[model samples]
Target: MIWPPTRPAPDPVRPGEESVWDYPRPPRLEAVRARLRVVLGDAVIAETEAGFRVLETSHPPTYYLPPGDIAAGTLVNPRRGGICEWKGQARLFDVQGGGKAASGAAWTYPDPTPDFRAIAGYVAFYAGPMDACFVGPDRATPQPGTFYGGWITPGIVGPFKGAPGTMGW
Candidate 1:
């Protein structure tokens, strides 16, 4: 059963609290794939119908796709792993495309909960780790550090709560 019929309304921003209500909703199924183009150096990774998902975080946007669609051959198995309260445990991978590729860059929830079945077996990339990540028709250089992905567009206003110290806001 879907937990909430619709996402809960963001909490009200109190005085001195960082406002993050303007954050964009997860990209629609079509929008995410339309703007994605995978490349390995000069070679274009085949464009296929890969799954995509946006995790809720204060940082940039996170894009998820099936391992079959990604050039997994270039990924180096990493020893790090993490768990998500809403999803499940994640196994990390380091991109090994020479020194240009992002290291320890991707992660996957091999066995997510039923609600997150769409993301199961799919790998998600940190937009910050990629050289280029796009949303819709806009192409953006990934932000530095560990950002999720940003969906900021004209008329979009967001402070997206949960950055470094703004967790309780």
Candidate 2:
């Protein structure tokens, strides 16, 4: 593995599309107005139009919804946490709703670094574990890999990180 390895060529972007390769390296947090929804089993556990997304090079956006927009009794903080160089510490949450539960499927930064302070206490879900996740009306696929929580929507293109052999990137 090489440090500062060359990035793979990004997929061709059609009109009105976004290439993840064009995103910044340290990542950028941006407010989003499109409706974001997370469904588990038969329940819609989270929905919001006032969410935010973190975009980084070689990755699709990771959407964060306000805690107020999530259903009551759906998130259980389990004391598991992780550190991100860009976002600071993140506390993990188990998602329990719609007759199902997924452990560590969600996370939040109770006290985020200043760059991401706007999303403090907001939660981001791993779309792969949910029955469905949507950005606007488009169903989102989970970004490839076990670790990253990016949601791949229709308009986002990538040769994203997280696949095997990309860790060095």
Backbone clashes under 3 angstroms, per model: 5, 0
Query: For each candidate, what is the lDDT?
Result: 0.53, 0.93
Question: Model 1, which residues run further than 4 Å from truth?
Answer: 1-33, 38-48, 55-61, 141-156
Q: Which stretch of 10 consecutive residues in model 2 shows the poorest summed lDDT?
A: 1-10
Give a tens-digit lDDT track for model 1, residues 28-143: 22225554544444443323455564534343445666677776475677655787666678888776542466667777888887767788777766555555445555554443
- Model 2 misplaced stretches (Cα beyond 4 Å): 1-4
Best of the candidates, lDDT: 2
The TM-score values for the models, in the order shown, are 0.64, 0.96
When superposed on Cα atoms, how far off is each prediction in RMSD? 8.2, 1.2
